[model samples]
Target: MTSNSLFDNTETAFKLKSDSELERAYFLFKMISKEPLVKIGTAVTKFALNINLPVEGLIRSTVFDHFCGGVNEKDCMSTVDKLFDAGVASVLDFSVEGKEEDEQFDSTAEKVIELTKFAKNKEAMPFSVFKPTGFGRFKIWQKITENQHLTDAEKLEWKRIEDRYDLVSKEAHDSNIRLLIDGEESWMQDAADSLCEKMMEKYNTERPIVFNTLQCYRWDRLEYLKELHQRAKNKGYKLGFKIVRGAYMEKENERAAEKGYKTPICESKKATDDNFNEIMKYIMDNLNDIELFIGTHNESSNYLAMDLMKEKGISRSDDRVWFGQLFGMSDHITFNLGAEGYNVAKYIPFGPVKDVMPYLIRRAEENTSVAGQTSRELTLLKKEKERRKL
Candidate 1:
């Protein structure tokens, strides 16, 4: 494997964006960098939408354009094409959030299945993803997790959620496209884990057609992954997982504090970072039986994984090891890694702007809390602009 500076080349990284687009990205990040401004902006954006204001144009041109692929699956193909041209893969994530009706849940399930069919036989688009909470009520999931006996109607509702999972998994299995089930809060994860485990048992016996996400910020996820690994071995199935530092820190911490429970989150960022790297090392060490998709923006951890692959004498082009970052946030990691002949992909989420506002808000909040996330992006854009003499 070639040992290149993973993030030093701005040209290859920003080649996908033209000067105008790059400038827009810089301006957007600049706005996001002001912490108080972002908080105010988030509140105002939500209020405007609630009163049926015409803010979709503003949102669609800025954050939505940067973060999401488009308003629909067909609309995402242009992005899929561009990334594929650059040798990067696409995981088409249906980004619609906060749906609760039975009809809405069924529609979300069918949308996932349709994406699987669309991605079938497409080398550029290999994976389809969805969040369980998007398809079912969160309270139901929490109740199921607590093993509380459900009323007859709640039992039926739970069955509907399980049926949706079965349909989504079956479609992916039939289409031979991998499916990633996004993880949620700790209270609801056990139910998600159970449904995903059932899919893995049925579809993963042949290969890894289904994957469950592991959020490493949770203190218990490392042990959870270990138990899953042991179960995979005993059941004679390959374990597939997408690991991340996690996305729900504030909500988790706030809820734990409100409920007077010990937080499931790691005490410090360093602890979460340490846990993430350790889990990645474990996966690489057991690469023969496990497939790993690393979803992180941390440059050091990315390099650490590359070094581990080299140390283990694993080929950089190995199929089992893949890297992922969000569509418009971590172009440096995605494009540079793709340029280096490693398997890399962007999590390209698409949905109507109004429907995806919850996701957009979370992304904004994440940038605010991630300490220099926006500034880092702004710095890279400035460097590229300078390189281009713009």
Candidate 2:
């Protein structure tokens, strides 16, 4: 705990009701910091073996309890109600990932639409999101992005993707539920962006019903934000942009090297941060032209948003912009900002323990990979504990 925090009457922290939450967050932080928990490398590595060694039980108790609303919609009743009591809402993300087979792709899209149905008539969950990879095989997605020729079978596979998206978007539009399309790896992102833009064109006319995630860590996305905004303007539709720093930095650079192409990453944290805040400013300056969601844990970036809201003369609760943090890591930011009456939502992804494993592995790696993220979480937890004298 910082001495400053102690004197600031850390009792204010109590209002967050995060004492127990911090304990769980801290434990997970320490546990995931170890290499054994964040498995990667050759598909059949020790990490993979270790993940299967009955650790699912432990993960369900700790991370699932803290992060997920639940594995299924009905199961989320308790968490949803609890968050509502705290003046926060949820963004339901069904976290089933990585299926190479077509049947698996089709099933994921079906589940996404089903999840949307489950959320209909439900007030607490305002939005539902899908990854384009959920609808198309990764290899097929790669082919489509490169504009390379594909076999007859591949064209059929691509059409199935279009059907899945049309099905999901129809349900979302009909139910009046917002759709958030998550960004993918750099290699396959062009297709994701194109599909998301197509949906936004169809659904985001008067209001932003389809939101596309922009990963600002890519050197070009800041400018792309403006380009997309301009396209939306020319085409006469509202633009929905969710600004995130990015997710697949390591894999992106690695693949670039393998393919012998220039890396698309921003090249430095400063550049990424600069681009991130710049995009935020751009969207804020044109709020009527766009809806913005700031999906980041960087404090400065988060505050930059608050500053923008003030400068634009918009209230904290104005729906034009939303502040988001992942499920467990930034409760202080999420809850505090929500407490201040800013529009906020937690990216609440849930699924069967086994189905969500890859997501968990990335999460474990995220806390460690993002510079100081682990220690920053620890420091907050440690502060709350000392304040509670626990």
Candidate 3:
């Protein structure tokens, strides 16, 4: 397909939405475009939910519907079917957050395994994902990061975390479902990365059944990718990777400031973007041993990957490469890429209103903070709506 035939076709992008739904998106994006409003709204919504106020309905109809799949696995099926019909795939992400108990971790692991099983033999659902922090204790990760000694009881607790990872990855391998380990705060990422590498060694020998996320916004990650590549080469296993600019920029900078250490994050968006694109190129050059999932909303990076694929004579249907955007937020990129026969999927997060609020708030804040992201979304929606007019 021609380059022009790609993402500019907003009509194909929003074809899944009804006219009223498109209008609702227009209004929502317009509202979120205001930085001050988003800040106040996020704080107020969190406070309201914490106080047991009845704001679920308002949230469910607006941002929640626009950004997430649904309130549960069952509720997400219609969305899965819709995207599949449009030639896009689905990655069901259980987006519940902020828990620290052993039982909670075990439950999260089970839910991840259940999602992987649900995806088995299902064409629409190609992959399932979970955050390591969701199933591993944050304090354990912190202590390990700081080189602090653990007591026997704490050692036993760490054993349980390892067991949970083994259970989930074993299920994914047995079920033939691809599993992505979501990236988290920098402090906790070393433990997660090690666990992901261990799983990749176990499950990704013949094919990539496990993926570790690389957050390119962190200045060290490009060098880190080089290290991971060397390890994969030495171990003789295919490396599965998901690349993103990252999520915890503000937190990372704040912590670095408070601790009087140089920040790990790139100093500017340009540096991050450049690092991300360079990583994309590096992975493309090593496609023989790397399976890549390009996860971003940036148009330039998306196009750069597409161009790399074409230049390398990689087929659009190549299973080793995929482009992913969050559901409902980047329909133009997701659906148009799908229309062109490129492997594409959405990160369709699902959970109850209260449980999913943190994810929702992040989406809101990200849109507001990212330069021109909200305005760009609004522009595309308006273009599509105008095109549909007689």
Candidate topping lDDT: 1
RMSD of each: 1.3, 3.4, 1.4
- Colliding pairs, model 3: none
Model 1, residue 177: C-alpha shift (Å)? 0.6
- lDDT of candidate 3 at residue 133, scale 0 to 100: 80
Q: Clash number for model 2? A: 0
Across 18-100, the per-residue lDDT of candidate 3 in tens digits comes to 99999999999998998899989989999999999988999999889888889999999998998899999999998989887
- Judging by lDDT, tell me the better candidate of 1 and 2: 1
**Candidates arranged by lDDT, highest first:** 1, 3, 2
Give the per-residue lDDT digits (tens) of candidate 2, residues 1-116.
11222222334423545567667777877766666555532133335545677756766787777767677867777777777667777887889888788888887888888878
Can you list the residue pairs that collide in candidate 2? none
Give the 10-residue window scoring lowest on summed lDDT in candidate 3.
Answer: 1-10
lDDT of 2 at 222: 76
